[model samples]
Target: MARILAEISRTFGEYLLLPNLTDERCTPGNIDLSAPLVRHRVGELAPIRVATPLVSAIMGAVSSVELAIALAQAGGISFIHQNQPISEQAGMVAAVKRHKAGFRHNDVNIKPSATLDEADTLFKRTGSDVIVVTDDGNPSGTFLGLITTQDFNFIRHRRDEVVDSRMRTARELVTGAEGMSLAEANSLLWDSRQDVLPVVSADGRVTALVHRRDEALHHKFSNETVDAAKRFRVGAGVNTHDYLERIPALVEAGADVLCLDSSDGYSVWQQNVLAFVRKEYGDAVRIGAGNVVDGRGFRFLADAGADFVKVGIGGGSICITRDQKGIGRGQASALAEVVAERDAYAEETGMYVPLCSDGGIIHDSHMAIALAFGADFLMLGRYFARFDESPTNKVKLAGQVVKEYWGEGSSRARNVARYGQGKDLAFEEGVDGYVPYAGSLYDNVTVTLAKLRSTMISCGAISLRQFHDTARLVQVSQQTFVQNSEEVQRNERPTVA
Candidate 1:
């Protein structure tokens, strides 16, 4: 008398169908258990890769420190949004790094006025393609002009009269506000018809230069050879109002990749935002757009000439979209259908549109399926919510204890973000919100990532990208969810981080 199937994984948020994972079947170790992740290169930088193939949505302030850090540390990247002051975003990013030592200089910047020779030397010596340009007149340290090594070639060979003569003025070059989303930047770049962009500060100072590079940094997803790195590449999500208004803050803050942020990305405001980016900023920076799941939104974004499209309705732990709106696609089903059609579109036009599967990947297998189904990058939101280092969670939240945390799209977030202009939280709690107490961030990140790495090794893949290509996936119905319950619950690790 065996009940063929009974309820299983229900206790652990019905989002997951199967949760029983043992080291043996889960992963190997230190091997390439991934796929050829980075694709669609725009220029010099490596095609972008989200650690978890997921990201925290730019939901106002809700994608607080806990959420963003937990996702990033767990191998997913989170976009810090305009939920609050510019300073808060910086602090949040700082906190995302599991350890201080792993972060490259977050604020690494250089002057655009340095020289064409300087530009060449920097690239040749350090092999770096990105640089921050500063101006004395601009408080944000952006400039009206910039000179790249490519432009510098003419100056170096004496083809131009001087560096100043060969320079592309900020007006002539593409420019994305530091505050804009990556999608906005890409859209602007495409419309501007320029390859290079100067990210300017609030005062219009050229803080850094963002540009699209070449094929090495890109890969073909399905058929169309869209440049993943070039398109999905994003800038730091600054917590501010008026995306353009935050540009100066972003430039000063050292964000070159722009991720145009919005909860529902298919709206007129979002489209107009990208259009404005395309018209005003032109083609200075690569753009990334999303937090969308259906083809309508995807098609809309592509029709808008978005270089890359983000796919996902609601997959985050803290997300209440389904509950609030009663709309969403199961992540796997969404990715499978969308990716297949997207690939077909690519085959027909030779213009591949990349998809970032942005949610509901609770396990490593989900990551593989996302890539196989045709997602270029995965942006996990809640998985990274509990990290110890994220700025959003300075303190812990518990009944007896209190920690710092916020919701990206919460009413509280809207209120807290309006500080300084007599609009900021003058009423509802001046200080940031806190969560019930949680434990250390490092402990959670280290163990989880190690397992992910080991999982990758078992697959015999060198990287996450390869895992997509090599790993095979099968979809299971609710029955799988039922049988795996007790084991998953029993083995379910402590709910910390």
Candidate 2:
């Protein structure tokens, strides 16, 4: 007789979320969705925190700077994709970091000698209401004066008037030193009752501008994700083939986190890449790595200094790794197993590495399910792909607006340009597809989060940790599963035609 072993695994579809006993004291609005979803170590230092547990996957051209900025403002993070050139990718990261704040380092500037027509052109190009008048028209140029929408309104005569003729010269402007803190700069603006404050270096070069309106906007969002510089936080992805060249540019471009992106994370190539990065970058930056589906793989990356472990292998809507290569795991099982391992590892060595569930979430309820299974956060591709902010163009499909979506392994995704032909592939692990157009990414996220909060309230859990601790899973009959799915969708706002 031969010995036999039993095996079992679970997927999100195989079970139904069991609600906890309702707490009459709890209400939907009372549920606290705020928590550090990602607590990953940066370099050789303590862990840094990302505000929310929701993340947008780096889906080639679909993950643009606009999407990243939107996600950041909504209390989540987006990984700027690596399919493009390093400069372009870095520029995307740069744009997100520059999107908003009290002090905008990249505000539009104009040379005093430039004509009003030139000023009009610059205003249109940058979409700025105010332009700083500088000696060289650079952010670091010597401060000359300031021009505002009010200044432009005064231009009733020739549109060709020079900026210097109408700009309020330095003598008439309130200025602060470049090294002043945001609070100090803000106070100067308040005391002087000015809407803008020009920050100048010791030699009188304009280094940055502080806007009262920006400060007001910053304080309006109590949960905005920001870096140490108080700029909005963002992440970017890198491949092993270009980590050296790409990492530096991303870091210089103000990337708050970098993930080692790959279809597989257990190979020697990824290990070597980790070693090289640890040696070169030390602990100066936080690094996230994975796409691993087992505890062994998680432990391997953990020992090699992975701060954030991306869980799930073939669960993405576009991924076909399991069907094509016969290598993958059920996302629920993978998340639970790895999270248990993380707890064990934390017990053994006093380090708790956060795990990100990289796929298999189809509905807002699935997000709650993932969190119940101990996923520190959830990462999505198709969900975010359907949004207007995604880089793909909207087209009419059967009389309905739709957007193109695909996986990294898909030829269309790797082509580097829309409508361009892709090269021959050794193997195909993903398919090119499209998603029904969702209006604003922000509005969609808002609705999704609303459902999540409502679900938490119904489950008697107030926070993510509480949900993890109290929530349970219950398997349901195939009929019941169908009914539950339909119920959720029926309650959901219409998404597709």
Candidate 3:
């Protein structure tokens, strides 16, 4: 006999938060968005905590090396997608780990002997206007000279002219040593009135370049997510089939955390994966698991030693699992049940496993609502895919700029291991699509975080923990939901045109 739950499935759209009485101390500035990223005892701190409650999803289109670096600088983390080969994925993780604040170590470079035509091609490939002329044509090669678009005009210079002909030689440039602090480098850059300062090793190899603009940009992110070594924090996704090979590579590459990327994670395969991770790493590594929708599923993963449990199924903007397989739950109902079970488990076992609201975050307000529902953090795919940093290309669609966004289960991704449907996908559970271009991750995330903080302040909460404990919600009827929107529309309607 099949058992059906009594509660009606509900979505975030049907619920609204009721504003609480604001206190003098409940200001937006006082709100702390930090949350634990892993499981821990009630009285102690988790081994990992993110400054912000947002994490980019583990999708090929959303989480890439560039996106990971950008998100980490904005106080969040990104799980580099596992759709590519293990080595490629590992390299992406290594790239983020190698990133230094206010410094560019992987800037475009070319050999001095290369032609201006070759330099132009390199510039277009990297989307950089400036290129370094190195002895070996690599970023770490012996410092030679610097070339910018300003150094030559296509109409004025011949195509075959060598880069060294027009470049500013090392002798003419002001340089910093490898061990110089970012502040010290900035001072030198400003003092020398140079737009760029190359940091060179004792042997005259270029180690990094400090750009004048990056110093200002770096100051805006006071809460950057970084490891003990001060390098940016990054996560990597792994599938069940290749965990044996993938896990070792990612860990060796300095990935801060790992997540099991599966569409459905309440199966024996997930348990086996968790068991293997525990047996081999012995808590030295932090790995999260799941895309489960209910309390039973949450308990299963929690008991299996998942550092954190991911919640939600068939609720992603690109996912169609519910329509295809008829296996899904509403985002709100799923969060409600899983949160209750998480609390109960904490009371019984004294271990508090964090819950991550994985998908269905269509709006910024949804983030506040998820927090009220006790989600320790959020995993966003579409929200991140719209940013310039995402791996996919941006295209002009219907006269509007948009970025490509696709699900792992879509034909475009064909991530069979994530779906666990065998060696290849039997059917599509996701869609390929586009999202409106939302500009830089920093600018968009700034607005989103502002809205979230204001929401928390309106609810009289000064921290995520306080918001979780004190927030109130009301389920709106269909009529009330319509009326709520109509009121705003009515107010904005053009007067008697």
Candidate 4:
């Protein structure tokens, strides 16, 4: 006799689950949310470690350097979109990597002979508070002197004055050597009693700059995510087809993690690409592969040496894969099955692959639901797209402010020159759409995290690990669901006079 598997599937909205167990010993304030949401090696051979589980999905053009910086500061990682020319995408990655650090290697440099008008233009353009005055206006040029905002403020009315006249010469500024450590640099700045310390080479070329206040600010952020260079850790997406050309450029540009972006991960193209990356960069780069739904798919990727696996196929808000192709699985069911497989795979192979739930999150509470179902972290496009930092601008739609959002498989996304395949798309797996504008990313993440913490408290689980082990789902009647929705609406609606 042959065994038959059940044909049942579940999704996030189909039922409600509550934890039956509670430990009075645990409190919400004491809950440690700092566990490694995702653990993978940076390069081919490094030891595994944790990163914030909340990841930003690769939304082309809409994935901005500012958004990446904001997420890294909040202890999460953002994937810079790869739909443009290699250089443009790489530039965005480099910008995020260089944004904030103990030392900024790419700090702005100005020519000593340049005028305040020129410096003002540079300041307005680059947002740098200090500019190093060099012989040739490059970091490798001979160091001449430096100019700070105070220099400009003093000469505010002298709009036509040359930089050399107002700038403080190098002799007056505290200087450090090129190879000095951050601690030594800090000590030098403190001992010299200077706000800015420039590090220069033996031949007098500028190497890097250290700010006493920036160093102080860095120490205050206990949850910041950074790479070996102490730059905010960031990831980028590359399709299986062009990864051969895209991967090298991205890695060189300081991408901390690389995701294999495909609508389907079980195809030969994905496997070939994954194998090629592992072969070429073995253990040198961390790679994640996905869009899988079941145990077999997860097992295949795991065996193929993927550092992490993404779960979800057609569960995205704009995706039509399930409707058009009828070849996708419900996110809830898919995540459950895959999570079990991940646990089993770890037991069998002793290598744990972190799972990322890729899409279909709408409400803040859904984030908690996904984690309870065993997602190590949630990858969001729609949620992140609503923030002011998204690359798209807001427009008024029906009296409400909204931002443009589109899926990678939509015509708007696929018709780009770099990603254009020459042949017309047979059918779109995604659609272009809009989402209501949300405020700053900081406020949004803070509110969501607060709600998540509240959910954890209600579940009596102090950490995601505990929730994964102890949480259970319970089916509720349609009436109960309707009542809850009505209650929320009533609370949100304004009362009539």
For model 4 the TM-score comes to: 0.77
lDDT of 3 by residue, 17-60 (tens): 99998989987778899999999999898888988899999999
Per model, state how many residue pairs clash.
Answer: 106, 2, 0, 7
Q: Which stretches of candidate 4 lie over 4 Å from their true place?
A: 1-5, 20-25, 34-51, 99-221, 415-422, 487-497
State model 2's lDDT: 0.78
TM of each candidate vs. truth = 0.53, 0.75, 0.93, 0.77
lDDT rank order = 3, 4, 2, 1
- Residue by residue across 161-237, what tens digits does model 1's lDDT show? 44455656666666777656545655676688776555566766544443443211121111211122221222355
Model 1 scores a C-alpha lDDT of 0.50
What's the C-alpha lDDT at position 193 in model 2? 88
In terms of lDDT, the best-performing candidate is: 3
Which residue pairs does candidate 3 place in steric collision? none
Between prediction 1 and prediction 3, the one with superior lDDT is 3
lDDT for each candidate structure: 0.50, 0.78, 0.90, 0.78
Candidate 2: which pairs clash?
Answer: 43-283, 44-283
RMSD of each candidate relative to the true structure: 16.2, 6.4, 2.8, 5.4
Error of 2 at 176 (Å): 12
**Best by TM-score, which number?**
3
Off by over 4 Å in 2: 1-9, 24-30, 34-46, 99-221, 415-424, 485-497
After superposition of all CA atoms, the RMSD between model 3 and the true structure is 2.8
